[model samples]
Target: MKKIIICLAFSMLTWHSFAQDIPVKITKSELFKDEYKNSNIVLVEDDGSGGVVIVRSYAGGIFSSGYGYYFEHYDSNLKLLKEYEYQSKVKKEDKKIYRSILGVIMNGKEINMIEYIYDKKLQSVTFNALTSNINDFDFTSKELFNMNSKDAESGNSGKDRDAGAQMIINEDKTAFAITVDIKDKNSETHKIYLFDKALNQKIDHTFKRDIKDRKFIYENIDVSKDGNTLYLLGKVKTDEAKKKKDGGRYQYELTRITSTDEKTQVFDTDEHYAASLKTIIFQDRLTCIGFYSDRNDSRFKGISYFELDPNSLAIKKSKFNPFTEQFMIDKYGKDKDKELKNLRFKQLIITPQNEIILNAEEYYEVYTHVMTQNGGGYDRWTYHYDDIVSAKINSDGAIVWARNINKRQDTSVYGNPFFSYTSTAKGADAYFFINTGEKVRKIRKDRIEFKEASPKRSNLTVIRINENGDFDYREVLDDEENEVPFMVAYGELTGDSVFFLGQKGKKKQLLKLTL
Candidate 1:
């Protein structure tokens, strides 16, 4: 559940404090048969019996009807033990379909698979749990809830697409919340449902407000430690004319929900604008933090933090810390016009000492035209994943250190499936695993760069940032020695281990890294 890593650009910092290289191991599975060659891993978990459970979806494979799943059980040695193929109940007639996996958790000796499904005939959406025994693979299904969907949002643009629904699990995974937006006359209505890990419903409520002048676009959600309260963050859209006078057309709002009442708080600052916001409970307090800009320009100016009253959703303590000079130099070198923009939050880590580590990446899109030989052309799109920014904030909401990692990667592919990095924390230190081909180099007195690398023939490099903000890098998997490229972005962190799935055509393997 803790996903994070750090990159350093300070030239004077020291190297890794650890004496030895981090332990890593790669285990290759038997070549998947041609019939199931195009499968991708959807879930991986430790079986609690010196083995692992991996679930793969072959929905778009040559032999699949776009609804088949492969459930595999493997021993400690990565040897396949047993496997089963399961398909969903689907109709191809004249109906829109939507299904998205919520999560999977172990229940006794069985695994409970939770999914959100849209029932076309009934004109509604339902949460369903499919339980499968680990020993004999016996299967059963039960409906968790069925709700109206006449004007609800749907995510069914194509096969294997995610539904327009979102779910958030608490730190302990003991409880979860699902939120949906329904179309109304001029704005939108929100549906919030809370449930325990055992598929028991806790609260079902709906909220409607701000419909006359603005609409709320929900972004993130979090639950309290006891699962009795829910927090929702969203962007409140105002009139477009406000952009010319105030330089911003949107403001941030935080909504707190309980079984009996709902409250909302709008974050309005006269001097600055919130570019992004995420909520987390730290030190027994509800805290909201993100990036902000002096003007409503797309560029960010610094980090923002706010400690809120748990019951009122009101800001009790707040700070807006501007980026240090060294961080700006690390990102733009000497370019005065270049600025940081399009940062999407990736990981939020809270240390033992109550320090917060914030991580994000620069992502954007571009469109062009590719002409064919016949003199006709088609539009081409490229998704860019460019840079990494990390910062450490102390208990007083003061930023202690902030750094940026420079890299450039782009792909026209839909998933961008293999480009981003995955992270795990080692105490106060952070480690990032990425695929890169170029050598690490110092670009300036305060700038360090990790050049973009080919995804197919790249080295798996691990970047380490110690507690003091000093950092170093090492290649764990050399491209020449390893043939399969890992989908590093999809790696899962479990205890002291990280699991990743590697695939190349008809060949697939499982890679485990022990920290």
Candidate 2:
């Protein structure tokens, strides 16, 4: 008998499969409490050991008071190990407190915690009173870094920094932090600081740019697993050729920064800025992937991948339009308007094997009608149609397969046409999970399609594809009604049981399956 087994570590279940199965049924379980209902949860493996660590937040005491974030350690069996919480005050006079937990890092034997507090009194729409604190904690003792009473009044440069910080640990156990400065006039100035594992400061570096009218937006940063190299991702804005009456420009440069030989190298491209970019670094290759959209035309978007030499940090466009020519032609059609040909890529994914998958949602125009009093009749109204498409490309940017997921529909606004496409070792599949309306559509190697319905049909769906690029299975759980399966994660062939993260009413639960 072919069986699939899934395991749930904490409130979340990571699915792994050993074999393949078609038309598999997913079960559900109640693993534990739903403590992180409103807060985002980052899952970290336990210090190269076994187990998991969760860093989360709680609603502050008073309204508009912000959040009180905390960290909890758990074992492989989902047993809680320890929990820690921290709070911050924004200003001296404002009794109200607004706090946020930015990021968390785990070194060999210690856990590093960082947070930010915003005060209303010393605040401006563009700037506010902010304080950042870093703490190092072990099982028995805790040490606060750069936390001196005298240092508070000095307004030391670190006190006013932004709360969005990232931490990376070196091979020697030292830690480094990179944070963006929103208060800087240039908005392109970013701060980088290095620290020992004990949270002691080492070297402080700053990267500043002087492009007029263009602000810098920091996207993400990472340190090499060995800790010798640091990678910074951001975008630079440029003034539009022509200014609008509303006071904003129309051009920008997407930028990347890499540190080597104690010096930083910058790579700037004239691509439109995007909200986020994902970077993956292997032993010899560094890959950067970002989804870009043209502001002048919302429909113009695409995914661009850059391969950089780790030592020199020089970027060469690795794979542009990896998807096949036929795939693109079939989706857009030869007769479509030129603007349709320029549709933007809204979603993209890179597989472990280095293959790039690009998904683009078509764009359309919307027209509104203004009623005329003299005409005694309503004016005609018209709207544009946007197409939804998905395409697969090889490592060299050659299209492997392409399909149009949506045509034009009058009942709905094309539902944003962009579908979530990720590479799985089992194969490739498209996922769509909206709250209360979750559904998993699986396309197998044989071109067979299977779907698992979401419970509560709450539109919230979780889909998992194994490392082999094949559809492992899917889980749909809802508490509004008690009609959930026993487990959620059922591998394709390892075992008959399924593993799942379940939600019942107000509680988040987990369960194991034995079908």
Candidate 3:
């Protein structure tokens, strides 16, 4: 047995990854109630001191789904620790309510559900829900912000409107922040609220800016660990750009929003095209990365990366293409036109040693014939995946290593959940879980391909990448006969094991894999 170790900033977990038959303990927890059939719920992280604390709540009422809220907590072993129901003493009509999750905050032993209540008639929405203790669950409510709704007739934000408010809490729990984005067509505005440990508002501001004819398309926004600054990654889309200058139609955009100042920055590469620009915060620095394609082409021909200081908006590293020439030749041969395009960047993993790993899969779309009730119809759908390429960027911004797990596959169905893999990084090595078709064999081409099968089968495969950039592959759960529904889950790496909740039809199955 080989012991696998992971170094997490807040905690640690150890597990064994053996090649032999590893017995897994599966525990099926039936969480679906009659009302919960909707599946709109909340899950809180375990403090990991005594017993794991889990929360299950309803949007409307407790029993009849009328008003107020319901909460239930359980231990690590799925044993009910206690439960509580918070409602108005003077109950009114069972009208519907609109709400959205800002985020969850864990202070001491308390798990706070920072949420907002929306009202169309009123100018602003209300924010509340905080748990001081299990029994003393405090309920604080207030109107937080005011904005014009997409539909004016309703006079409210829409009785069932959820603006998709996001919440962020600092590691020490001394600070908390809630952010909501209002998108209009291609343009968007972000509403941010900063709070102190006592749930007092420290700063409240709204960021709305237009760049002439270009609309600011917001990506992922990060609130610095200290809870003082917000780094927003967006794209400016314009169709009027001169073809000789602008590659396709968009520019890489980023905005730093603070109390006193707001700075918008753009990355100009003359004719280089960009797709799927994303930001990842590590240490105190923010890294923005995505794939670079040819002019007017969305298919990726290369990759681009840069590091920036969130506080000063200074470029710590000039933009660099870490995709080496040797890597391209090795994967796609010397034919530049036949090179690996359509590389879908799945994730960015940074290690404790400042090693950056970029994980991507070769994905594209194809139009084909399908059987319809009337006759043969030409339909369009996405053809996902082949070969997962993992590149390691060194501490000094140098390309250190690039490894890959060869897989040529496409599902009979559509959607990303059926194609892409989920991963967890523990120290230098990382693990991935994705469904694989029959075992891959040796091949010589631009990319590897899987042999044809009568009926495609999905086997949950586990891929491990070691510190030295070595690769290991194994099938953890096999469904070759296609009798079981394919399970796709992202598991948490706990102490010496992984805990995952997989959905099989309407039921939820929990598995504890101890290496």
Candidate 4:
């Protein structure tokens, strides 16, 4: 195993005008020594104390050690306490076809590493939980579940749909849930599991009744604090829907699973279609917020909110608010084609006051064919992360205001990790952190745009939107003052503070923003 290096120095950055009104404190650690630049922060968790635990994974190939990880622990004062190198056990001789780390969890006195591995020779896929004590740091692996790869490959027909395992952890981190879907030509099967923070399995059941007429894809899952109940939110597709199409032909469904029975609610109305939906248990109530579109059309028209009975999955209150005029102008200016499509849900924050701050981004992919000299061709894909639409919903389920942030980013040159942004909320104000070029262009009186910036000369910018939907942005960290570039998309938000890891070449640093 390679001995990991660590060096840390702390400094505070001064904020600009608007941030001064509410005091945005920036604490940064100087660049530390690292051997691999192909690393990204996967988790930044607060250890019950004021300290934090940061975990990053470094890439490895057949020539080098297999994929490995670095676990760094820091005190509340931003000083490094300890670092651990989890050398990958999978060598080239292992012949593992595919592997991915789902998430890294830090519980009371333990660290849980949840991962998925596919074995080509055995034709099996396994979900394993690697557990280590905080004091001992020695890991033990346990297989939580397994599936046959043949069933997954034969059932999956599209690129967007994933037939493997999916994991979700609740906001409080008390429990987590995992769902796996296996489908074949004749039948389909679904498995849902709930586990406590200590990796104790609470509920394990197979769901297969709802797959005869339609296919269901679950996007969100949450387990109760006690790990006794499970909730799932996803989209359902019926035979009426055409191939390679999206819109009203599909409907959103909420399933509540308990130890005894399961209840479901389909959120399909005659007037509008739910383009996207995300759910959270706030104040002991099952609440959902998402975007809606006019009948059958995939283009979004407004925001949608619903309050449902937690146990029965019954809708108690519902509201659909159209986009405001100012929001349309902010997004489209004077263009005749004002349709908003391909908006994926990014963040949904419920404040202490019971208000909701919702955000989504315009994202899509374009694939092109490149020909070779032998009359054969290969497919190349480009990912686009574009404009962001943000809105605020009052406690009564009415949209207070909606706004759009203009930006354009693609993965043709730079990677997708540097394109999208991260968000956190403080009181009534919502903050979005992104990386932009040297200058942000102000095209309109109140609108500004963020263009693609190079990694070396990027500006870590923060856009703050008040409760009234009025927003202002400024550079929190400029390129000249900072040597390491911040990966805004990889930030971890805990309460009012968010932590980001900045890395450039063989140097990396930790950045903390107190909003």
My TM-score estimates for the predictions, one after another, are 0.86, 0.57, 0.73, 0.87
Clashing pairs in 1: none
Q: Residues 1-515, candidate 4, lDDT per residue (tens digit)?
A: 32335544445756545544546788876567665556778777787788878788888755665677888777776777777888666667776567777777777878999888888888988889998876567889999887887755422445235466778787778888777766644444567888888888888877654454235665677776556788777777756553424346666778888867887898764467776678877646788888888744568888888989887788898888888887888986743335688898788887878788898898888989999999999988888888988898987889888988999877764455666899888888888999898777777655678897876568888888898888888778788878788888778887678888887767677789887
1-515 per-residue lDDT for model 3 (tens digits): 11112221221123334573333333323332223322222444555554444443334445544333445455555444565655433234313445555555555666666766555445445677555565456655544444554422132344223245667665345676776655544335567777765566767777776553135555666666666766777776655443445475666678877777888777654577776666766666777776676654556665667777766667777554535554554466533453356777676777778677788877777777677888767665746567677777765555676655666656555653345665656677766767766665656654443432222246666677777765666666566423332334344444444554443344333334434
Off by over 4 Å in 3: 1-17, 20-44, 54-97, 130-177, 181-188, 196-198, 212-214, 237-249, 322-345, 362-387, 408-419, 437-442, 445-458, 478-498, 513-515
Candidate order by lDDT, decreasing, is: 4, 1, 3, 2
Candidates 1 and 4: which is better by lDDT?
Answer: 4
lDDT (Cα, tens digit) per residue for candidate 2, span 1-515: 10113335334344433333333333333234533333324424343455455554456444444355555554545555565554344455556434454445555555555544434454411111112222343233232322212212212354332333445544233455544443344335555655544555555556566743134544556666445456666554444423433312332223333342343444432444333455655567666664444443233344545667666666655543433343344444432322234354554555555565555544444455666779655534333323445555455545455554433322123331112221122234433221222332334322323222333333223334333333333333343433322222111111233323434444443333222
lDDT of model 4, residue 169: 84
When 2 and 4 are scored with lDDT, the better candidate is 4
Q: List per-prediction Cα lDDT, in the order shown.
A: 0.72, 0.42, 0.56, 0.76
* Runs off by more than 4 Å, candidate 1: 1-34, 38-40, 49-51, 61-63, 75-79, 89-100, 156-163, 212-214, 238-247, 334-338, 371-374
Return the TM-score for candidate 3, rounded to 2 decimals: 0.73
Q: Which candidate number has the best lDDT?
A: 4
* Candidate 1 C-alpha lDDT tens digits along 1-515: 11112222222112232344554454455434434555566666778887788777655544444565677788766667887777664557735766767666655567777788776777888888888887777878898777788766565532112226677777656678887665565655668888876777887988676553135556678877787788887777766425645545677778889889989988754467776688888536788888888766568888989888888776788898987665777687753544578998878877778788888888889999999999999999998887888888887888888877787778888665578888777678777788887576667666667776776777777877678876777777778866477787777766666677776665566676656
* Model with the higher TM-score, candidate 1 or 2: 1
Model 4 spans with C-alpha error above 4 angstroms: 1-8, 13-22, 96-100, 117-126, 143-160, 212-214, 239-247, 295-297, 334-337, 366-382, 413-415
